[model samples]
Target: MISALTIENYRGFKNFSMNKVKRINLIVGGNNIGKTSVLEAIMLIISKGDPQTIWKIISGRGEIVNYVGIPQGVIQPEISVRHLFHGHEVKLGSAFKISAIMTQANKSIDVDFKIIEAKQVDQILYASLPSEGMDTFGPKIALSITRSDKKNPLLLSIPLSSQGTLKQNTLQTLVNINFQQFPNEDERAVFQYIPTTSLTGQELISMWNAVALTAEEKRVVEALQSLDDNIEQVAAISSPVIFPQFGQKTGFIVKMRDLEKPVPIGSLGEGTWRMLVLAIALVKSKDAILLIDEIDIGLHFRALSSMWEMIVAASNRLNVQVFATTHNNDCIKSLAMLKESEISIQRIESFDGPAIYYSADEIRVAATRNIEVR
Candidate 1:
């Protein structure tokens, strides 16, 4: 797991550092404070010098406009990371700096690259640190989903670059992107980034039914199906669907639940989709870093507490490290309900021009008194 992540001269942040990531890390701050940029930095660093892949993961579309904000037309953003294993400390450094000189008409940016590993450079096979029982892939797995904008929205069945191009090869799963071509309007993409196993609410219910519950996994499935409000009950249905694969073109026909047979994903009630995605991600994201932004987007106040319980359990079972951002105080309160074993919470705030990260204990200290470090 990453012990610390450092960023310099990247989107909204001249310099930022986040350390001691536990099972669940929550970033709380105002907009444009680089919360998402921190996540983007992880994805870029893990891409290991592949600008194309980095661009796709960060911006969805491979566009230069996303990089326009960087001071100086410099490309290849710089990032550094520290990883800890057992008793050993491994420090990885990079200077993928860019040289851009502004001019009257236009400006130019040149990308430069530098890297250092703990021991010998040549001995390292991948760019990221290696962990036991897990493939580091030279960097960490950063799953990011940005909300949609009015002009350039994402579409359903959006083509994965790897699905067609030679250079397009990635081990990530993005689902439920919707694009529509209206007769009057010039094709609008409704939703931005929604990651879930099923596309529709009906499909979601079907998936819930399809889950071949083991004696242990059954407890989780039962808890999810027996929700109080909106979701009267969850019933599984049979369906032939294409399951997600990391690097291969392998898919399976599985059973799923129909959460929308009663209503559309747009109407099935808020947080329904978000909760479903969280459940599925927790189950599927074994040994991977799952990034969830604005986790409390939808759902009633009561649902928030239950959702946290489910999330905490899933992370522990799957051994997945989760990074999430939220501004909801209620969501934080819900997390406080968890037992020590259920979830480990790390509170981080962007203040005083930089990010201040704290462990659960440290956060308690700051909260006990009127300690506004900002």
Candidate 2:
């Protein structure tokens, strides 16, 4: 688990730090105080500065800039990648960094990220391609990761065309440092980020496919059982021709004791669907990291306690480290009530100073006493 984290010039934070991290971290803060950005930084580090992650963050914020008429005139997006920085400016020498210290027993790995202008990025991304046709060589950002031996760091190429950048696919192509492909046993890590208000049946199905029939699937079913004990089974089906009646929306199916034939998961309430995706994500992220945004999106206040209870047990059982965000007071209070020794709350007030952490007791106090932690 991460023991400490630092973010510099990412999103709305000029410099932010979260120390003494625990197994389950609940991040709360005032609106626009960069609460979600901290989760993004953590996910990026865990992925070792993955290009898909970069695009996910930008796309989630509606920062992708689509082109108008020019098909191949070699033009970069009008909005530069600098928007991720402190002043929203990205000169040739400008860069932002995210680093974390992961600790287990007596061993630890230090993960770091440096986001800088493409020109400033070193030749770490294999032999440099000819810079001739590069899109005016503007201020495109390149992300590099260095957990150890910065001399041989992994470099990434943002997916946006060097010749011309459109809004779509702003960041892509993560090279080197895929821990799964490396020879070292200590470097491998599993990480997944589930964005807010974007959970879909198809996406949940795909995640389920990654680790189905294993102990993870059983944990998922048990997690959903928190919502209803009658939820005997859940399934993900693809290309249902004979069941063409399922049509294109035929992705998730759930079996309740009352139902004769299995019905589409959509027949359930939003809380069920939300819990389904959350549980799947949590289970598949076993012994790894799971970052969730707006974790309390579609659940009733009364259900938050039970939902968190199941989640906390699953997290402990599977050794998954979670960093999730929610703005609701009931969510916060319920979360505090559900906390074991594994949880802590980080309240992001602003970037003017470092992040402030609240103990589980403190959170409960704030909730019961009607105090404003945000």
Candidate 3:
């Protein structure tokens, strides 16, 4: 687990630091304060600048720069990776730094890289991006994502100009991440970001397929039961007539004691699918970090306490750390009622102010006293 996180010269933040993090941390604040950017930083640090996340963040902002080869080839970064820089400016000597320390040991990771102009690109060493009316390599940008435990670490350098130059062999996962503490770690610490709204039928089905393959299905069912006790069994169903894709992903079906036959998951209500997706995500995120944005968006106020209960229980059971954001008072008040897991309520101020931290007891007091932590 990470005890502290430090980010410098990243998007929307010239310098930022947040300490006193715990097993389950909930970030609360006003809008446009870079809450989602913090999660993106954590993802980049843990994944060691994986290109998938780079595309996700950029495409999430309506900027598409990924290219594919003739027939179903590896996805490569285009000229758009420069969007990662602060203010979308890719000037030389401008860089970003992200570091985190382990909570139980002295192990830590420091990742620092800068943007530099690449005038020449050799096909053997790096890929070349071709652009119109340019020099030999079409004004390429070369940057390497390198990390280590003070030893010889892994380095992945890619060119930002060429289309078909990048392949699967050019990029890789982080090596000896977290000071080599997890040299053999099964999964990366970072997971995909679950949006605030409920997942679509296909999205939930995809995640459900991942969870169904593991022993965590029972845990997911237990989590859904927290929201509604009538949930008996949850299953995935697919047919040529019912699904658009042929068995690639399946929709959900649930068995209720009152209902004679299995019914479609959507019939149970929006909250059912919302809570179900959260549980499935938790199960598939073992020994890793889960980033959820606006976690309390779709669930009703009455289910807030129960939702927190399931979240903490599953986090402890799976040894997963959670970082979520919200601006709901009921969500904050219900957070204080959780007894199974430790909580850290952080208040992020706008304009690069220091983050305010609050303990569980302090949060309970704030809720009872009607104090505004936000």
Q: Number of the top candidate by lDDT?
A: 3
Task: Rank the candidate models, highest lDDT first.
Answer: 3, 2, 1
Residue lDDT tens for model 1, 30-78: 6556565555555544332233334344343232221212234433321
Whole-model lDDT per candidate: 0.42, 0.68, 0.69
Worst ten-residue run, lDDT, model 2?
166-175
The residue-by-residue lDDT of candidate 3 on 331-356, one tens digit each, is 99899877634788888885365678
What's the lDDT for candidate 3? 0.69
lDDT of 2 by residue, 1-374 (tens): 78888888776788789986888888988788888889888877776665555556766777745534335665543324556767765444456777788777434444444454555443443224323223444445454445554575644444233322323313222333343434232244467677777465556665776557777777677767887889998888765332435443347888899989988777777788888887888777778998889888878898799778877887888888999998988888888776487688888887856778887777778888888876
**Candidate closer to the true structure by TM-score (higher is better), 1 or 3:** 3
C-alpha TM-score for every candidate: 0.52, 0.80, 0.82
* Alpha carbon lDDT at 162, candidate 1: 13
TM-score-based ranking: 3, 2, 1
Model 3 scores worst on lDDT over the 10 consecutive residues at 169-178
**In model 3, what are the clashing residue pairs, if there are any?**
128-162, 129-161, 129-162
